[model samples]
Target: MTEATNDTTSPVRPLRDALTFLLIVSATFGLQLLTLVTGIIMARLLGVEGRGVIALVLAVSVFAAQLSFGGCLPPAITKLLAERGANARDGLGHVFRRRGWLLLLPCLVAGGLMLVLLDDGAAGQRFEIAVIAVVVTLQTLFFSIIGGAMQGEGRLVRMAWVALTPQGLFTIALAVVAALDWGWSATDVLLAYIATGVLSVLVAMASLLPAERGDDVGAERRVPEASLWSEARGNYVSGVRPLDGLGLERILVGGLLGTTALGLFATGLAVSNLCRLVSNAVSVVVLPRVAAHQGDPAQQRAVVRRWFTISLVLVGGIVAVLELLVEPVIRLAFGEEFVGAVSVARWLIVADGLLALRRVLIAALQGQGRGGVASWVELALLPVLVVGIALSALRESLDGVGMSLAAVGLLSCLALGRAVFRAPSARHRGRATSCTQQRRW
Candidate 1:
């Protein structure tokens, strides 16, 4: 199949496909903008210390949410859901029925661990942070699963809504508080954030029900439950384990260095994340497209190479511009209080650019059923990250922490690139050889 191949599960034309990609990019951009605004409001209202608390809570929640997946169910299931005529409802239900309860335990453990280990002399607020972490975990899981379903069905617009709604709602709440000059504390901001998460989940869930009303009429004919889990487990092996560590970085920074440093790092990281706007959208859109060409090794490589180039060129340019403007942007938009974030943001921008490349490569590898290659590379480098951060913190240098992240990102990008561009599998090569002989015959 070519890049524009139309099937029941993917777009039919270049124009429609382009529109789908643009919609996702626009939504992602909007979500990031809202997030930046929320950060600005939080920094202005809560100052550095309060913002640090918020950062820690969010980091813990995200870490726990992704951890509970054991590193593969989301992508694996989403890929299965993309099979033409697969019953989306059955696919979603089967996994939830088997593994749904597994999600809560990680959240509880992460929250409890954070509460026990990190006490910044604010026992009351610390308890609140623990509670918020659990709530945020549930919110993130629901959003991700529902969004994955949307993605699986090629419902790109609905998927984008799932991505945007929570941030949008939370940003509006913060705006109201800012305009009215309400005496909202850090705890109150978290409460509002969780509330929006709940609402967004409800909205996303409702969207699926109506759209899939008859999608499961012949559920037995769809992909089998056993097969789905089997592939999910395969994906699980590919490990993407780096995320487990990345998620824990905030908790580590908070416990080892204190919230003030975390706040500075979080602010800088947030600003640098804007550089990922195009790459993020590209990563999301590339998965199924690459998967669609899985039967043809050459086609799969072409797809991966084409999108990889696009993501690198576009994201590279954005990183360049942001590097020049990040300091002023942080100073003016986030206030002079966050000036400490400038160096953090600069390092993170370089890391984010490298990360943009890594994401596309990882997605392509996953699509090609070679996720194990990427997974092992990431798993090996996981230590480099943990040790780097610890040594950096021992010296009391947040810039060193950021540099460590950039270093890992660069290494992962290069390693994954080599893996992605390596010779096709033996099976594919043999198939090609057979085809050539037959044609000669």
Candidate 2:
């Protein structure tokens, strides 16, 4: 029999794929730009030291969110949804319910952690930081899960717009606060941040309801919860590897070097990380499609080659431009107070470019249910990151921290490259050539 018929066969598939990629890239850029603007607004309004407080708060909240189901489930959900014979509605609903209860653990843990860490703030201010961290964690979880579902369902165009919800809402709130010239403190800005999260969750949830109901009518058979969790556990590690660097680095910077240093480092990270737009979008678009076509090794190889090549070219251009323009851009956009971020931003830009390729390689492996391979690779690299950051701190050099991060990215790309691109063994080739029966994921 001929292979299954799908959108891949359409005559306009190239154009359509190009448009979808653009949409995803645009949305990702919007998200990054908004985050940069948010930091700028805080810096301009609150000064460097005040921005430091907000930085510490966000570092804690995001770290906690990464630890929870929000950060862990997206890749897993996307892969599950992309299974050709799987029930998107039933599978999504099943996994959502199974994992929703655990959200509380992150909320409570993050809040308590933040409360204990805030030694300098007034008791009321500390309480607010803790409470807001809890709220942000939950909201971020909803955003991520819904976004992942949308991607896995192959609604890439719609997913792009939905991805902008939280940041869009926050940008608007920040604008209002700034325009009104309210004497807003760090707490006020954070209050505004949490308010947007609430609105974003409502909007994202409401937007998905119609699709969920429509999916109800044509739902296929459900995958067992046990199987889903088995996949999720491997992907959870794969997903959190990036976050481990992100969450812990920020906490360590704040703890060892102080919040002012964190503010500079965080802002640099936000600016430099805009380079990830291409790779981030590529990973999101590539993973589900690869998963859907998992039985075909040739198709998998071709898809990875095309998308990963595109990711590299685009990211290379972005890193070069950012490297040239970042110093000026930081001064012009974020002001002189954040000029210290320039050194940090420059090195981070290189690191981000390396990370761009690493992510695509990881996505390819994850789509094949071989996420454990990449997870082990990252686990081995984790200590290198810790020691590097510690050395950076000891030297009191942000540039040192940036170099350490870049080293990790370079090593990860080299390691994962070997894994993803190596020639298939005789056994693997035989399995690929002989397999004709449809296997359940």
Please write out the lDDT profile of model 2 over residues 326-361, one tens digit for every residue: 988899988988899998889989988887778888
Worst ten in a row by lDDT for model 1: 1-10
Candidate number with greatest TM-score: 1
Writing each residue's lDDT as its tens digit, candidate 1 over 281-362 gives 7866676677555557778789888888888788888889999999999999889989998997899899888877888888
Candidate-wise lDDT, in order: 0.76, 0.75
The TM-score values for the models, in the order shown, are: 0.89, 0.88
- Candidate 1 Cα misplacement greater than 4 A, ranges: 1-5, 8-12, 94-99, 211-216, 219-225, 237-246, 428-441
TM-score of 1: 0.89
